[model samples]
Target: MLCYEELREAVDNGYIIGDTLNVVRKNGKVFDYALPGEPVRPWEIVTVESLIDIMTELSNYQ
Candidate 1:
């Protein structure tokens, strides 16, 4: 998960809250985009199955 302050800063700096951002590896040799865009944080799981599961679970919570 992205740090609270990091998320805030990102948004304040023009990054959309739900925008799927890329996670660049520490070595700067690798990077992956977990989501598309709009309010999710970094390091958040973003696989198609995971997304479906999350949506289902969230819907249940609601």
Candidate 2:
């Protein structure tokens, strides 16, 4: 699982939204992007490391 810090950065950068109730797969893999202001699931796992990679890719936007 990725760290929270990296996930937060991704959320802040608009790379991912952490508001889904239960977007992950049954085995705790794969995540669905949530809309803004949506309620987040209590057991949702934030992937900071994954977010870092996503954000890094998005940073190339001009």
Candidate 3:
């Protein structure tokens, strides 16, 4: 799993491109996430569950 710091590092290094994720917030907490190319509004109710898959995918590029 990718911890907060690791994910931040990835973003800072440009390993994860911009607009790759769409995050929605309610009351200062994450409510949902949209993958690349998904809608930006009418928020889809979904959970990220885990970042293991994303981390694995990003690893291939590294």
What C-alpha lDDT do the candidate models reach, one value each?
0.38, 0.46, 0.51
List, residue by residue over 1-62, the lDDT tens digit for candidate 1: 23334434554776534433444332332222233454445654444323233334334433
Give lDDT for model 2: 0.46
Residues forming the 10-long window of minimal summed lDDT in candidate 2: 17-26
Instruction: Write model 3 residue lDDT over 1-62, tens digit each, in one string.
Output: 22445665766887556534444445544444455566566544544434554445446545
- Per-candidate count of clashing residue pairs (backbone under 3 Å): 9, 2, 0
Give candidate 2 regions above 4 Å deviation.
21-62
Best by lDDT: 3
Q: Compare candidates 2 and 3 on TM-score and give the better one.
A: 3
